[model samples]
Target: MPVTQSDIALAHHLADAAGAVIRGYFRQPAGLEIKEDRSPVTLADREAEAAMRRLIEAERSGDGIVGEEYGTKDGVTNRRWVLDPIDGTHSFTAGRAIFGTLIALVEDGWPVLGVIDQPVQRERWIGVAGRPTTFNGTPVRTRACPQLEGAVMATTSPHYFGEDAALRYLALTAATSGGHNRMTPIYGGDCYNYGLLASGQIDLVCESGLKLHDFAALVPVAEGAGGRMCDWNGDPLTTDSDGHVLAIGDPARVDDVLEALHRVHD
Candidate 1:
């Protein structure tokens, strides 16, 4: 389906508003609170989510919302807005610039629109189903890395895999027998990594311990850029997936990686 101009407008507005809230707390020393899950939270997270939720309600009252900060509202709709108000609250609390905001519109469980806004970095990645993905406003495409050995892979955190997950990841990379592998620390880079993958700057990203809002906005962007995104088991990502995300520039390359990882782990 053709992406509507209104959808783009709303996405831009949401990004800007969320950016404002986050930027307001960007460098300021703020108190941090721990959620029941023990993840850190800040005023920026709460305020930005509240602002985004308010905007969605006022502008798209009939639509449903699934947000990380506030949880779900209403039921599934033809259009559902999925949000991660502040993707890197850890970085935000640390006064880092790698954090971002994620917003996606899912139509019948498929993402039709997506936006990854990095306020501190001043970059925005957008994707509309059936349209080319964009960084800032320019078109972007995934890299042409045909071989898994020639690919560059990234993950959110090795800790998600366990203390020894890094060793396991390194072994996996080595087995790819295709290209160089590097792991970079990124805050709020989960969705942003998919953006990078779409831009062809990065070839693959494997991450676990993610939530629906964490990976939802990235699916369309990756798919729109000619890449494939799924769980480690090669299943399509949904709200119920175990937060394991594997995004790669080529399906064959992704399959090769997944097969190798599973064989070793299984």
Candidate 2:
């Protein structure tokens, strides 16, 4: 189904509101607390999520919501909004610009609308399933880098991998001739990187430690851009997986990286 302009407008408004909530707390002296998951949580994160939740509830009354800060609200609507109000709480607390907001509208478990808003970068990427992806209102497409040797990859954090896993990842990088591996600690940037993948700016993105809110929106954005997103084993990502994601510009490159990852694991 084609996405409506109303959906886009609602997503944009939601992102803008969330960004304002996050920016209001930026650079202000505030206390940080740890959640039970050991992830850092700040007032900005909770407030932003709350603001987004409120806007979504008001605008899309029949739609369901799954948010990072708040738990799920079971509804009968086939359309649900998956939100990560502050994608990079760690980076935000550290005064970094890699954090952003992730929002996706899923219809019947398939993402029909995806939006990634990078407030610090002042950029937004939107994708509608079976439609062209866009960056700031302009259409975007992924590059044609099918070989691992020519692909550049990015990840949220290197410390996410233990010593053995890190070594294996490094080996995969080496096999790819070490093409511009960046470790940007941006939790929400995963979706942003998928936008870049669609725009041909980045070739690959691999990361773990994610949730359904983290990967669901990215699936359509990446695939809609002529790219592919999957788990490390080259399997479809589900809400119940281990939260590891591997996205690449070309299918061949994705396969190559997955093979290397499998070899390392072996």
lDDT scores for all predictions?
A: 0.80, 0.79
- Tell me the number of clashing residue pairs for each predicted model: 5, 1
User: TM-score for every candidate vs. truth?
Assistant: 0.89, 0.88
Model 1, position 158, has a per-residue lDDT of: 72
Note each model's CA RMSD in angstroms. Answer: 2.7, 3.0
Off by over 4 Å in 1: 1-3, 162-171, 176-188
Write down the RMSD of candidate 1 (Cα, Å): 2.7
TM-score of model 2 vs. true structure: 0.88
Candidate 2 lDDT trough over 10 residues, lowest sum? 179-188
Q: What lDDT tens digits, residue by residue, belong to model 1 across residues 174-225?
A: 7554433343333245566787889888888877778888888888788888
> How good is model 1 by TM-score?
0.89
